[model samples]
Target chain A: MNVAANEKEVKIDTAYPYRTLSYFVEDPPTGNRVDRFLEAFAVVLQYTDYKSLLDSYCTTNNKCNRCAVSCPVYQVTGNPRDIPCYRTNLLLEVYKRYFSIGGWFKSRLSSGIELTEELIDEMAEVFYRCTACRKCSMECPMGVDHGLVTRLGRYILSLIGISSKALKVSVREQLEGETHNTSKVPKVALLNTLDFLSEELNDMFGVKLDFPVDKSNREYVFFCAVSDYLMEPDTLMGNAIVLYAAGDWDKWTIGTQNYDGINYGLFYSDWHLERIIQQLVQEVTRLKGRNILIGECGHASRSAHDFVPMFGGKEAYPVVSFIEYTLNCLQNGKIKLNPDIVTERVTYHDPCNMARSGWIVEQPRTILKSFVRDFVDMEPKGRANYCCGGGGGLVSIDEIHDFRMEIAGKIKAEQIAATGAEIVIAPCANCKKQLKELVEYYDLPCKVMGLHDLILTAIEIPNGKSAVERKEEAEMFAM
Target chain B: MDAWIEFAKGPLFAVSFLIMILGLGRHLFLQLDGLVRRKGRRLLKAPWRKIFTDSLSWVIPVRHIVDVHRTVLFSVSSYIFHIGVIVVPLFLADHIILWERLLGFHLPKIGTLLADVLTVITIACLLTLLGCRLFVERQRGVSRVSDYVLLVAVLIPFLSGFLASQPQLNPISWRAMFLIHLLSAELLFVLIPFTKLAHIVLFFFDRISQVHWQLRPGAGDMVSETLYGKEAKV
Candidate 1:
């Protein structure tokens, strides 16, 4: 409402702080008109409203900027806009302007803010810049979860069809595509991958290993970021080897439907988040599995484990992370791991989705310390650890490779370097991808892989021949 | 001046106190309302004991010293300011007498010397915070006009109350300072629920929400059917 006759009229709703977020919107929003931005935000707000929480946060945010110290992106970029508090306020201010009583009164009195195309575009860029790590939430005296607000902002923007292409495309596929997985891996391909992995493990360990699929009435149905089959064969094999070694043959099996644990909706859309979790639940239900076992992916484990009872309703299966299951197995003497295999100095990178809330923090550390002889903790390890910079699904976006490397992932690169470790083990599939990129980009002398990737190397499986024995047998047998 | 001071301390004080109570009560209600999920069963397995103890850590004035070893001087000062501002007004002899008259009960009074020391400490902390908002480049960049205005709004009552208590310390007329102190505090009371000052009540809720992120199972299930598309639920 620029109803001003002269330029001298004070526009109270003038985009004071957020007007500066005039960056490029990666995925274009649906509506062309600027006013449509507000309508979309309103629709999303009503659809997934946390009014009391948003109202308090919007009312109480003092712009302390303390969160900047904890923000990996803000620390490297040194920009006010990158600050978690500022990023969160991008939505909070909108909440105030459009939803709150005081802002309504003030807006009615004066020229209030118009949700502009530029503002929506600004949000499109700002929200993605955050890894949604939730580290900043630790330092906030007001207890505002800046990452949660960023998620809310992203959800609103996605409603207007402005989310990152990487996240949107994958989520769209997972929702509507025949494969029902983010990576679009068909059941046949997944089974083939399992068969290939079984042969590889058999050759490596001189032991017969089977990657069980679609097996019914198992004690646990496993799900990991499905892309693991494409890139993380060792991790998948490690999971199979560990579960097979730790329990009886029928203890765990991978289901065909909803086998992929990567829930991109957790980053940008509540609608997707719920439905994706439902897929995982349906898979477990279909298998008649008693428990859900989420593999090395952080958000996959968290979203599945935390929300299963909610989405599953009367049939809430007990959900466990791979780390927790392995830790339990190790403690119970269910499996043995050789610590001597890892002599190189190693450090654990706490994935934000897993460790930020202390859900899967200690279990991984316990598992790592068990087999990792030279394990060293990062300066701010565990719940306070910095993001791998490619968090919140940014790792999936190849376009922001430079932004991820130099700015967003900068702190993580340095954190890895500071550890001076040869191998940096990140448990989450998302974190593993980001850290590998960070190491390569930053020119650090560290190799990145999953926790299970190393575990597979050191695990002592029954009927598994020693490496030396297997090598000698290969020469003698002349196969 | 005598009549104005009496009016400020008696009826104005009561009305202001009522507004402050009702306003904070309403704010407290809103915050509690936000915590409730209508569509699903609230998970009883949240580590509430741990969450409560962890949240209590935020209230300790110097927890930064123990938590980060950095003592984040800004927060420590803000904490002291918060503690002092609340404690001084409640336990100061004059305020206790007013409370006694108004509510038929009073908190245990602090010695005049101790009260004076706390008031000065609170004022100094306020100044330190003000300086931080003004001088610290990062904080100043984020600071709004309302930030400075609110600091001054809080300062008026404290500065005036200290001056009003001892006539010898008062540069302005003691009666005038007394009236200003009473009026400014009342004004702050009215503004509490609307401004950043709302944090005085909402901070606990904020902490709870933070812990709530690692939610108990299906905490968000209520919105499954009722919230967006009915077909949205699989």
Candidate 2:
């Protein structure tokens, strides 16, 4: 599946800095300071942590400005002040004016002009425009994390009531609802999805398997996003087949009630985050599950791997990413996959949530290599991987699509072109959706396949089932 | 005359050297105090391997020197300036006379004509570089007023050396070159503390900032807990 056109360098628009700047200027921090002792400390420590970051990473006025020029957001807006360099300078000015000797001398000279509410408002605007993707961190002579810096700045902004509406709503829902703003999904919808997946699997491969949803007391529990079930049913079906191929059909059950693994709590408030994850852990424990496997979602994986250990409070149980667990099963002969199932030339996109935040880089590659023969690697991969433009809730704001596609996907489009691989194996839900938009906009010929979909396609079934049989099984169960 | 040049040169070099050391020492002391008070442990404890191995790391032990790209013009200019600075003082016949008086030994002159030609070219390049820096838009944007002043400070030494080295310009070569070159270099030494050129002192602050954070026990979990609490179900 060779692409007809090469989208090697998609140009990002550098307009709209004023709008971004204005938004930051006007918007007050949205969520309340979470009650958790650690969170309060984390929120309070944001000021010192940010200063430490600057002191450690950006002390040089000369060397640390690489982020100002090369940043995608800055490139899009053409505003130096909104970028990390000047944003940092804003903080440094605060440090000096309020804290340093030069600041004291200048104050004495100027009759003591203190940092006011107006200053905080302007600085907040400058700070939040950054998505904190850490792309500029790659170019800095000092490996400074502007992403963490921006996040801390945004957190501080939240304390002052100046956060984005989309982010705020998402945070509110996660905090109160213990779900990522997704409505309470109908059990029938999930059951229908499982039935559909079962029929698809039967049609594609001559294997009859049950993908049970919300079954109590299962030995193994699998969690997936509700969005995957609705929009990307194949992602769900793919996971079903992988589980089946791994010979865990009898042991595993998919949760029917609000199976979304995405924790919006991670984005805004830490309090709701703990509540959400603890509930998930409780569900697993109540079911008496031996192992819990998370589906192909980036933020979800971050919740499981990063947030779970910290906030989950106890050594709950064994929790693993679907990719890792499936790969292990395949290696140990628990699951057998045919090479012909995934014959296309494919490349992997490392999700920011999994790659940068979770550090789950190698497992997906190992899984892909076992199934994909012509597996190619994109340059600037691993921890240095670019965002899919959808991770930080940017894709939800439909108005920013044009800029987001051009700016965020610009580098990703180049990485895809460099590979020349026919299929892109992005194991993330948001990354998959964004790539779909990119492939359409840029006219790239490659088909975007979720990691689960490819796994389902290649997994060796018990009977001699064709691809149609598996699809039938999936559809049948889904219905 | 030899004894007089020797006596003047020794005091001039000593004064200039002492000023540079004192300026650097005070700058470092302040930075250390700030580091301690601010708790810049990551930068303080940064390992050498982490400094060199990072993709974005450019190791400059000194701070005030500016970037390699931005400083290319100045560096190239300084090459010529430095040649004049060192050779004019060390290789010139008058300089040798002062050295002979001070150390009681006179080394052979390789080629006085070639030496004179090199000094002239070095001084000319140095002047040209300084002129361009003042005029160029990209250079001027980042340049402070003191940057031009430093360039002139550097240029005076070369200009005086060139004038002193020529046969026709030689009547007052010893005193004029010695006085102008020594005074200009000394003036730069004084101005360094007040100028952006003090990055020499600031470079250590920048390098100290370059120290990478090695993930400590509980640090990763602590960050996660703070960002996303344990019970977050989304």
Candidate 3:
């Protein structure tokens, strides 16, 4: 169906208003799809054996609404089915009908529904609807990790060849293909983009900056969301300026093999997540870098910092977020910032992966406070901040644009509007893209920028050569 | 009727109490066993100190339910109800006298007026919670048959006990009302392990398992330490 048609069908403030059998239906699989799905489900159960835990919350009359009250999607759509507990209950129903001991008794006692394609389709549709933000789990008195359950559901769906086209194309095909990045920018194009960004930096800042690529034996191997190289040149330039000013130019090099740090696998499929992490580990190892520095993307930073050890095992090197690295540089007085560079009121949006996952919360705030003179905070910022409505790879899929803007993004738009900040410093790439779109769609009269972008504006590069001299040197190098 | 009353107060109560203990014990043991098995596969070193501190924080209603979620009215009412449910049953003069007669144990008892007041508040809170489940759209969406049934199960005992204490308000015979109250209480005890009341024990375990359960420092840092054996740093 067309986007507009889908939007028109979705009625707000109703129970399962978007429920249509068409959205759940998929083409028949080639060979014995039911057996394959059940087999995959069995495999997943092996990995996640929390049947008792599920039972604790799944009991009849256990209407623990802690998760429901906190769920952002349910908060927006007002759909009971969208509640995190309800979603988890759907899985629990599946477990009870198929696997649990009590399920055996239930099947015999009642005319129980069989696990069919329709059930799988509904599960896929609902599971993908969630952002897997874990915000619900945070407030849940039972601590039922619905996020993990949703992820497992996605994994099982993928096994049955039921998955989102956007996730498959961007995360699986593109990353596994020759480009090795989600944006599909080839190596040549990447180098050319860097060169073009370098020229732009020279024209704008009148400083000679270099983005080292493929240089070996560096202290830090910088990996950023490849989209940043194309969409947010200023963010890339900001990263370069900070590294160069910190006198870590020789210590850091962007890997030629895997430049993008984004792991869409975290949002959709575990196989994709594992492959992405393995590729990152291989890239860092190939360069023999001391530390893996993930640039301003929340999920990528989190995946690299947390999942790498699980996937990389003994080969896993230390993974640090670019924000943490920058904060460390500032703390050690490795770089200086001109406080008057930005005078506008600035606020920060905590990416769910960073804030909720507890990866790099304070570092960004510390950096933001250093340069932003008129700094303000979004109410319930830090750990309690609302998602940008484009998390969980939702930003990549154009099909859900209206759903994001109207329902999911509603609370976030209000939060940003209430802040009344001139600029919003969203460090995560996904959040930046979402917030930027939100500003345009909501007409909120605020510009969205990366955290490093603000730092770049405020950073005072150490004086070494005059602007004219640097331009002449650049010209000489071009010759 | 006399034989049934004797059975209800003797063998039936003993049987229900046994079921409650064994059923809840098995449930808790299985849960902890799952944790142990999961730890082996995940290679997780338990952060006992942080777990204990986080569990304690949640145990205090002010820190978790009130301060964290800010559902002031619901949380406040829940606290009062829980206090009444626990305090009145153990310390009421009638229950203390019964315990003395049956088990040869005696404890200090609260004044009948105070017990009466506590029971009234407890019953009121139970009704308010039931109303919330029935009327609140979000709560109603998640509510199941068992939820309403469980609430009714709990309410019967409190209501009957309250009526029996206030003879002026009693609509039934004192002996009949008292017998009904004891039977309902025994039914609740038997159902505790099989129903949502398991949360009374599961709450501590669940709170400790959450990602937010960090007391030493930032939750993220603690997660990093647990996952990677070192703090997340450059």
Best by TM-score: 1
**Residue A83 Cα positional deviation in candidate 1, in Å, after optimal superposition:** 1.4
DockQ order, best first, reads 1, 3, 2
**Leading candidate by DockQ:** 1
| Better candidate number, 1 or 3, judged by lDDT | 1
Q: Please provide, for model 1 over A127-176, each residue's C-alpha lDDT reduced to its tens digit, 9 standing for 90 to 100.
A: 87888888788778787888888887877666555677777778878888
Clashes of 3: 2
Q: In candidate 3, which residue ranges exceed 4 Å CA deviation? A: A1-36, A111-116, A204-206, A464-479, B41-57, B60-72, B89-114, B211-234
* Interface RMSD for all numbered candidates: 4.3, 7.4, 9.3
Question: What DockQ values do the models have?
Answer: 0.46, 0.09, 0.23
Q: Cα lDDT of model 1 overall?
A: 0.77
Model 1 error, position B72 (Å): 2.1
lDDT of 2 by residue, A1-479 (tens): 22233444534333433334323223443333223322433444442333443443323443234455446565545554545656655555555555546567879887654555556656555564555566665455444556555554554455445556665665556445544335345567667767887887666776787766567767778876557878887788778777777677777876644466766555543444566677677777766676678899887886666556544556466668888877788779887766665666899999887876565799889888886788999876886677776666555445556656666566677778788889998888878888888888778769898988887766666665755455456668899
lDDT of each: 0.77, 0.61, 0.74
Docking class of 1: acceptable
Estimate how well candidate 1 is docked, as a DockQ score.
0.46
Model 2: how far is A16 from its true place, Å? 7.7
> Whole-model lDDT for model 2 versus the true structure?
0.61
Report the C-alpha lDDT of model 3 over A1-479, residue by residue, as the tens digit.
01112223543323343344222223434566667776766665455444445555444325567677667788767778788887777777777778777677879998876776666656766786787788777666556778777876776676566666676777754455788888888899989998898887776566777778898899999999889988888788888888888898899998888898988877766656766888898998999898999888999988787777667767788988888888889999998877766778998999998887645678888888886788888876776677888887778877777667777777788888888889998988999988888788777879999988877666777664433444456568789
